[model samples]
Target: MNSSSDSDFFDVIVCGSGPAGLSASLAAVQSGARTLLLERLPGLGTKLLASGGGRCNFSNLLPEPEFMAAFGRNGRFMTDALRTGGLVFIRSFLRSEGIETVAEDGFHCFPSTGRAASIRDAFLHAAQKRGLTVKTSARADEIRIREGAVEGVRTAIGAFSCRKFILATGGTAMPALGGTSKGLLLAEAVGHRITPPLPAMAPIPVDDPWVSELAGVSLPDARLSFTAGRLRGSCRGELLFTHEGLSGPAALSLSGPAGRAWTEHRDSFRLILEPEAETDRKIWCERIDDARKKEPDKLFRSVPGRTMPRSLAARLAALAGLEDRRNRELKNADRDRAASLFAGIPLTVSRLSPMEKAMAMSGGVVLTEVNPKTMESRLVKGLFFAGEVLDLTGPCGGYNIQFAIASGRLAGENHTGTLPLEKQG
Candidate 1:
């Protein structure tokens, strides 16, 4: 990267040094545009460093549709980026940079070195080698516009002029990583409408004694369903019981629906731990009967223990009022009660963890106002946006980072028309 004392003006100015800003600046510089990247933090990619619990699931190899579905309805906006060689380009770019990638679980990709710093270093080195200037500890407070056109940016350091500007400032997710409303604020200043951001992909706080009681217990896969009047949704993944409530991939995925059910319909959420195909309440009864005929002294808790943790099994038996009851002594009514509880347990959701605890925020810069193909703002000339600043969010497993990198490259490549656009039929 260029030194902090480098020149103030450039052909393109990228604000924020996360994945998007880094990709944007690198693209601009490679296209022979004089580019400058400004980062508010002393270091770069703080949030990226913290992604995937610090291991950093940088990208994924999921087919486009499955990848897009993770972001829900707003996912359609990614069509141009994904189809116009964005994902392929990123994979190729990383390989060319000598940064090896490894795919886990047949989809999620991470640095072979298992360090987020590797990705950050690769980007910073490439940008600097391509003659990109850099400024750390510099904040872009405002976009300087005049006569209904582009100009420069007002930053903590000073005003830097640019023919074109790209805003990759990100949303309010993790304050420790420097996520804030700066980019949203700048977009609004240019007359762009911003959808209010809400926390997405975070843990849900449930008001149940058992949730805390079962803290630290985890289920590899569980089905989570929520119902409140007209709203209903379900997600399946690993579930982790926390001191406060639920976490892990399944809980994070279900948080959105749970939030909606509580906010819109005022309903409680439910979880089906290790859900079974047999739901007639006879399956569990028969299993208990068979075990009783063999052992003749098996406890009721042993049935649930086969599929769940021993502590959770004991807790469920207690909740069903058969904690001390033996399998042989369990009446038909007792078996039915335990069967229902195991099928789907009810849990009261008080609220979701605050935005500061979320992995990503769900809303920003209305998608329609920006060109998906070019990552440029339709409302403002010579303006572009990318990353979490957009109105899109994806589930766990590297989808979010993939979008950020792809969108960043699009914004970088198209910000100044240096990289030619594809011919449309």
Candidate 2:
């Protein structure tokens, strides 16, 4: 990377150094454009270093549209960006950086070394090799605009002018990683509309204190459905019981919508746990009856352990008021109650965890304020945006990072008036 002492004006200035910002800087430099990457922290990719449990699920190997579905409501917003710079482009970019990747579960793509720092180092190395200036410990205080166009940026060090500016500052997730709402604030100052940010992929707090008792307990191969009044959606994945509440793939996917619905309707919601097949409920009942007949002294909790986790079985039995009842002595009322409890476990959501603890943040600069084709700001010339700063967020498992890289590459390539692949080294 270019030394901090260099005072030369750059053709492009990229703020933030996460995946989006780093990708943009690298793309700009590869296009033979003099580039400057500004990072507030002393180091780069702080959030990327923490992603995927520090392994960095870089992208998904599935088809583009199918992968876009994971974004829920705002999936379409990324179509143009992805079309210009998709998984193929990302894999090739990593390959050029000497970071080989392998796909797992037909979705997640990770470095061959299975390390997050490898991916970060690849981008940092590529940017440095291309003569991109990286300024660490340099925070962008404000965007300097002139005549409705980009002029330069005011940093902690001093004012630096540039021909083109790209704001790749990430959203407000993991504030400890240097995420601030400043990106939105900066966009708003330039006449861009800002969506109200909300926490996505976060754990939901359950009202039951018993949930904390089952901390560290995990339920694999289970489906969780969330319902608030009438709106309902189901997500099937592994569920993890945490000391705070429910988390894991299933819980995190539903957390955003559940949190929003719970806010509008504060009463309660239903989280149906369809562990067994719906059609097999009758057969399950028959099996339970046969077991009861054979083991008269056995408790109801003991029987459910065969099908469910021990902690979950005990919790369900307790909820049905059959904790102390012997299997053979269970009445029709008790049997029906147990079935109801098993089918649909009621988890009263108290609140969503803080944004700092979320996997991703929903909401950012409104789509209407940016040109979808080029990812350039409609209000400011020579200025672009990509990544979490945009009003789009996807589910866990590499979707967010995929879009960040795609959009970053698109913005960077377009900034220099060239296609992504054509500009690549």
Candidate 3:
């Protein structure tokens, strides 16, 4: 932070103050480039401040291959970005800035102080020391271009000229955090094709009222699966029933893929929730039989009730039409129905969490339009993009933030390093 008023020009300008923009500014300044960072919000990193319930799970420590896989098919787009500022670099960068990080669960990394401010402050401190100018409450509305190259950016305050610019404004997942389409619109106006964004990492708002009835109940280890059109994904973890629909890790992680599929086949979209995910149908049948033998007169609800929350078990039993029957009274058809229900309960998905309620989103700038190698626009010189603006999305557990920081650093470093061939010519 150059806390003083803005200058008319700089070597680089970063639009957005989220993790990616912060990293870009810091990297540019660290490389001796006169840099300016503009943020639309009054404060920086609003979404970041709310991340991980404010603990800010910032990175993951998995090996590169597995790490990339977490981001799905387009995960490989982050190869160069991650290589430039991966887990090791981030940990070292934080440590050098007097902030230490720890993977509290031996996976997701967070600041030792357990505050998002720690990471944001570290970047601010480091970047300011290197002369990075700051402007908040300033939104970049247009990118001035000349001969297919970025010249400067126009903001509400004023126009700032820059040889290089980085766009890391993120997606429209949370409007309260100032998430908007301005960034995407800015890129689109400059020739980059944007993939329509979809709300993700949020609960699925099902139309089924029975799930709402089981609100406050959770299956600690359940598998959520969805298959519709081009969408196919599954995750096993906690599945929580909410007043509106489903929440918890399993649902959140599956929400992205599920949303994509559901949006396409809204009327036919169906999900399967496996309460006994680890136990196959055969095993479930055996358990039900054991319950039948040991408690012949027990209500059939006690079958699944033994392994899961009684309320949910009772609901599933009711769904399977055995709630009022006893164990000994179950016909073979009832047995098969109960076992199948326990194995994989069919759930019709009516809608996904809206953008305003989402924690993250899937889809962004089409990956093909930008070079992950340098985070530069393939169609426009001196214009770089990073973070959630890209098409790649990962599961929960800090994957999103990790990519943001890494991609930002890579974009910053390369954007300010060498002049483009067109410029040189």
Ranking by lDDT: 3, 2, 1
lDDT to native, each model: 0.78, 0.80, 0.86
Q: Using TM-score, give the best candidate's number.
A: 3
In model 3, the runs with Cα more than 4 Å from the true position are 1-7, 415-425
lDDT of 2 by residue, 62-153 (tens): 78777787776567778888986788887787898787888767668988888998988888888889888889888888898989888888
For model 1, state the Cα shift of residue 325 in Å.
2.4
Model 1 TM-score is 0.89
Which pairs of residues clash in candidate 3, taking residues 3 or more apart in a chain or in different chains?
Answer: 1-128
Q: What is the lDDT of candidate 1?
A: 0.78
TM-score of each: 0.89, 0.89, 0.96
Cα lDDT of candidate 2 equals 0.80
Where is the poorest 10-residue window by lDDT in model 2? 416-425
lDDT of candidate 3 over 320-408, digit per residue (tens):
98889999898878888788878888887766788998888798889998988899999998899989888888878899999999999
lDDT of 3: 0.86
In candidate 1, what are the lDDT values of residues 119-204, reduced to their tens digit? Answer: 77788888889888888888888888777666888888888887678899888887777879888988998899998877778888
Residue 32 lDDT, candidate 1, scale 0-100 = 77
